[model samples]
Target chain A: MTKHFVSDTLVLLGRSLRHISRSPDTIITTAIMPIAFMLLFVYVFGGAIRTGSDRYVNYLLPGILLITVASGISYTAFRLFLDMKGGIFERFQSMPVARSSVLWAHVLTSLVANLISLVLVVLVALGMGFRSGAGVAQWLAVAGIMMLFTLALTWLAVIPGLTAKSVDGASAFSYPLIFLPFVSSAFVPTESMPGPVRAFAENQPVTSIANTIRDLFAQQQVGGDIWIALAWCVGLLVVAYGAAMAVYHRRTG
Target chain B: MSTDPQMTAERVRGPVIQVRGLAKAYKELHVLRGVDVEVARGSIFALLGSNGAGKTTVVRILSTLLKPDAGTATVNGFDVATQAARVRESISLTGQFAAVDEILSGRENLVLVARLRHLRDPGGIADELLARFALTDAGTRRVSTYSGGMRRRLDIAMSLIGDPPVIFLDEPTTGLDPQARLEVWQAVRELARQGTTVLLTTQYLDEAEQLADRIAILHQGRIIANGTLPELKRLLPPAKVEYVEKQPTLEDVFLAIVGDDGTDSTAGAASPAGTKNRGTR
Candidate 1:
């Protein structure tokens, strides 16, 4: 059974990846929004914002990366919605392949596609004079945290994917997700905000994540922020995964 | 439409699909009310019904895609509810809609299914099935580019990848052209000839007459009539034979006027005009 699950997931993942390759536009479209934000912020608003740092692009890069992931995962929900509408889900359910493999394939596809979009955003940031002096270990840690965040958000997208009645409804849930980074430390530091806004910024999952990545890139003092970010990522991932699986079982069973 | 008595007798001796008191309700609306069905091995069984008469609900339950709210159903001797995986291994379902992935090429769709079924050579199996369905020419193109008939054929070809003994077709010819519908009927007949048990649901009375060894009429969530076509016809009032021969149906007139080459040139021309009008709207 485990073997079948692995094989089935790999096969279906190949199918999804083929879809990505054929329509490279989905990735391009996903990356375009975050890149536009990055360009607009780093160039237009860079000088106005005071972060006490030489380059505003460096401070904004981590936040932009998060936005990229948020926008990219909506496509996951959209694709899942299309599959459900197309009756392919029913087809897969009636087959002998492992049941959970269908969900795993979509989740993993979201991970891969989002990773590519993140890399593109980072490359664009580098072209715009955004630099990171972090060591290999620090870079690996950043990648790990980004992957965890993506997994959490992708699982969150699965809920609307499985249950939404319309295509717009399935993807519209990500609007709040894309807006979350703006309320956090992604753009301006929490210190610059009022008491209430700063408190909210400091407490949400995105701020801790953005601060951790920004600090790592700047080679700042290591703090307890890493643990908080990991806790948030892991917590959301567990809850979303559990809920998505419950919905899947209820829908298919 | 002629059914051999010896073949029917042999098929009656062993049933491949059995359902007893199968019932399902969606909240307040009862969809299937105590439906019972038995499909003999190596025979074609058609469940006939009108729209919203619970034909699809029965198919969903028997194929293990949906669970029955009450009673038991088995496929290939495996309980559909408890042994779903085992039953899935022995059966394939081609749903009302052509379930092939639109993004993938016809060849890619077949290869994907074949690989999932753990076939030795997915490429070879895909090629063989594509050729068998006469989709080899369109195999290289993405399914989104294929016509409706081609898509339906590919859907059935995908279901045959594992060579499962039992196949469930839910309204297989629902939206197809007359020529395409005939082709699908021929394919279903060929499956039963090879000792594969076929359970198909249809709303067309002629489709049941053309393909089924036994027909069950499901009306308002109940099997109101079940028997061989001859027996079922016997239950109706005897037809009055006139001295003049009966005329051909309107369908025959339409087919004759449109040409039966299976290309459906009139529809081909008419559909583009229809789309143009819709586009303007």
Candidate 2:
């Protein structure tokens, strides 16, 4: 059974990857929003903000990467919703293939697409004179955190993908996620906000995640923020995976 | 997946598919209630019904996509509920709509299914099916670019991969033109000739009259009538022989006017050189 699941996942993965390769606009569109924000923040709003950093892009890169993933996962939901709408989901369900492989294939495709989008955003950051003093280990840690966050959000996206009535409904869930980083330290320091807003901003998942990635890039002590970020990612992943699987089985069954 | 010894022994005898008092219901609507059916091996069995009847529900339950609320169904002598994997191994489902990857080419779609079925030489299988379905010319083109009929043909071609013993076609010709419908009927006939059990569901009575060896009329979640065409005809009074003029159906006139000879003519219409290609082919 496990063997069939593995092989089936690889086959379906190849199929969806072909979809991504053919219409590269999904990845480009995913990267576009974060790139726009990065440009807007660094050029238009950077000098005015007091982030205690010489380059605002460096401080902003982590949040921008998160937004890139946030935007990219909507395509995951969109693609899965298309499959469900197209009747292909029923086709695969009725076949001898491992059923879980269908959702896994879509989730993995989202991961790969998001990785490419993240790289594109990073390249744009580099071009805009964004510099990181971090070494290879720091880069790997950052990559790991981004991937965990991606998987968590990707699984979360699967819920709407399965249950959405329309294409727009499938992707609309990401708007709040894209808006999440704005309220946190992603843009400005939480200290600058008023009482309740600052409390909420500092307590949310994005704040610790952004601070961790930011400290890593700056070669500063990550402190307890890294632990908090990892805990949030792992916790969200578990909850989202459980919820998504429940929804998947209920919908497909 | 170990097969039950009793099921293996039973596989050599009786019907290829059997359903005993199958029942299913949504929250407030009962879709199928105590439905029973048996399809003989290698026979073309049609579940005839109009829209809102439970034809699709039966197909879904038998194909292991849905579990019946009550009763049992076995395909290839394996229970659909308990031995779903084995039942799945023995059947392929071509859904009401063409369940194809629009982004992928025709050949890619075939290869994808073949690979999913764990068949060897997926490329060879895809090419063979493409040729068989007369889709070789448009095999490399994306499915989104193909006409509706061509897409249906590709959809059936994909289902043919691995050549499972039983096939379920849920209104395969619902949205097709006359010529395309004929091509699908021909493909189905070829499958029956090769000893594949076909369980087809459709709203069209003539399709069942033309294709099925046995027909079962499902209405209000029950089989109101079940028999061969002649037997069903005998259920009513014998036909009175009266002289009447036979007129050609709109389908015949449409096919004649289009001059479609089961070729891939409609597929070309979507391409830039469609007209030129049609003339040459």
Candidate 3:
């Protein structure tokens, strides 16, 4: 049974990936926005933004990575919405394959797609001079944070994908997610915000997550950001997972 | 994983689906009200209903996709609510549209589903299913390039990868030509013969007449009638049987009488048989 779940999930994941592979545009589309943002920021906004660092690209890359993931996940929701709308979900239900495998496959597909987009963004940042002296541990740490964040957001995406009445409803929910980084420490320091905004900027989950990634990339002391980031990621995962499961049960019940 | 026919045979004996007092409601809309249906070990049970009459809703509920507001149902003896994973494990579904990913080739789609079901040899299963569906030639072609019928066949084949017991087909062949519909019907029949209990929903009464052993008519969120074709015909107040040409078609008389709203003095004209129409809204 466990084998069935794993295998079925792999198959479905492949199916999802195939769709993504065919639409090379989706990956390219995902990479484009962040790449545009990265370049524009580095060349245009790079000098004006003060972070007490040698270059804004180094400080900004981490937050941009988070943005890439956030943007990439919207596609997850979009793909999931398409599948749901296409009646594939109904088709999978009749098979002897593990049911949860369907959702997990989509989740795994999101991870893979997001990873690719992240890599593309990172490569673009490198070309644009977003260098990091961090070693294997730091890279691994960055990857870990990105994956957890992806998982958390992916699960959250599941809710909208499953429940939305229309394709627009599903993908629209992700816009706020893409815009979230702007409010946090993604492009600018949270300390630079106005009094009321600063409190929210410092307290929001994305700030800690962005702070952790920035520190990890700069090879600076991560301090308590990593712990807070995990807590936030894990917490969102738990809540999103629980809510998604409940909604799934109610819908498929 | 187990390829033994005897094991497959044994798998067929168990009641693939069991339902009692199943009910579904959407805020003030009662979709399925106190519906009870039990599909025997390996038989085709068709639920006939109009567009909003809850055929897909019932199928969804049975396939472990939609939750019923009130009811007790099981797939392979697993409670749908509590044992949802098991129900999902035991069943497969094919809805209105071909759910195959257009970006992938038909073969890739099949293999993907195989891997998701945790099958041992995804490629082998994909090959067999392609052969069975006569899709081997088009296996490598991206689904986007395939015709509607091909996509539908691939979708059904995908559902069978794990050899699930209860398969829910919700208007599986909605937009197909006559030949394609025949192909799907042939597939459904073959599945029944192989001991798969199929719960099919169709707006096409001919499909129900041709495929179902036991038919349940759902109308206005409730079951108005349930029985065989003869039994359902018997319920229809002896509507003036017709003797047509030697090569008469079901469509000819169906259109003359059931299709029209009682202007022809021969249709028995009794308010258009409203209790059920299957998947039509």
Candidate 4:
């Protein structure tokens, strides 16, 4: 069964990757929103917003990457919802293949697709005069954080994908995630916000993650914020994966 | 629709599927209650019912897609509840909807299933099924572009990969037009002829009448009637012969008007191969 799970997941992963490749629009749309936000923030809102950074795009890129993944995972939910509604999910379940391979395939596909969109967003950031002096290790750390954040969000998206009744409901959960960066240091310093809003923003997962990635890109001395970001990503991944599996078992059991 | 006597004797060899006191409920709604069914090997068994009669529930349970609340069911002698993996190894399900990947081409869908089943030479299996289903030309095209009949045919073709001894088709012809319906019926008949035990659910009485070796009527979550078509016919008053004009059904007129060649190009190529395959079996 374990062996079949590996092979079956690869087969189904190829199937969904084909879906993404055939319609490149899903990837473009995922990147488009973050790119537009980067442009608006760095060009439109950059002059007035004071983050003490030499280039505003440098500070803004981290939060924008998070938003890109937030938006990209909605497509993950959408694809899973389509499979559920179309009855293809059940078709796979009824077959001789390992059952868990069905969900794993979608989750891995989300990772691959989101990574591409993240790369696209980063490329756009570079074009917009965002430069990082970080060496290979720092860049690797940033990539690692982003991939962890993407995996955590993707598992969270799986809940709505399995349980939502409508396509709209499946994807609507991401709006708050996209909105989260706005309240954090993604746009401006949390110190600029009112007391209550600042408290919420500081305590949230996005602020720690964005701050850590930002520091990494600038090649600044590592601080405890790295631990917090890792904690947030790992914590959310565990909780979301547990909840998604619970929902999966409840529905298919 | 003649019953092959040799296959009938083969059926007596054993029941490929068996169920006893099966029951299932979704919260407040009781979908299936104490349902019992037995399907002979190498025969077509139709679970005949109207919508909301829990025919799908029964199929879901047998396929191990859903668990039953009570009693037991088995496929190929393996219990559905405990030996689900073994049961899955011997059975395939073509759901009410055409459960296919719309983004992938017809050939890709076939190959996907073959690979999932861990069969060697998935490409060969896909090509063979594509040719058998008359989908070779559309094999490279995405399924979303195919006509309803063509999609259903592809769906069934995917299920035939690895030739599992038992197959389940839930409402295989529910949404199809007359010509597509005939095409599906041909596919179902062909499966039984190849020594596959088939369990299909259908609301259409004529579908049961035309295809099943034995028909079980499920109504209000229970099996209300179960027998061969002739045996079930015996339950009613015998027909008294009287002179009456026989009028052609709308289906016949439709088929005649549409031309026996079939409006869909892939439709005309299936029958001859179907006959040839049946003869060899």
Give the best candidate by DockQ: 4
Positional deviation of residue B52's Cα in model 3 after best superposition, in angstroms? 2.2
Q: Report, for every candidate in turn, its global Cα lDDT versus the true structure.
A: 0.86, 0.88, 0.78, 0.87
lDDT, candidate 2, A137-220, per-residue tens: 999999999999999999999999999999999999999999999999999999999999999999999999999999999999
DockQ of each: 0.74, 0.78, 0.52, 0.90
Better of 2 and 3 by TM-score: 2
How high is the DockQ of candidate 2? 0.78
Model 4 misplaced regions, further than 4 Å? B1-13, B236-248, B261-281
Q: How badly does each model clash, as a count of residue pairs?
A: 0, 0, 29, 0
| Model 4, span B146-229: residue lDDT tens | 999999999999888888888999999999976677678888877877778899999877778778999999999999999998
TM-scores, one per candidate? 0.92, 0.93, 0.81, 0.93
Worst 10 residues of 1 chain B by lDDT: B272-281
lDDT (tens digit, per residue) of candidate 2 on B8-116 = 4355578889999999999888889889899998899999998989999999999888889999999988999999888888899999999999999999999999999
Candidate 1 ranges beyond 4 A from true positions: B1-13, B236-248, B261-281
Q: How do the candidates rank by TM-score, highest first?
A: 4, 2, 1, 3
DockQ score for model 3: 0.52
Put down candidate 1 lDDT per residue, B208-263, tens digits, no spaces. 87688999999989999999988887664545212111222554565566556343
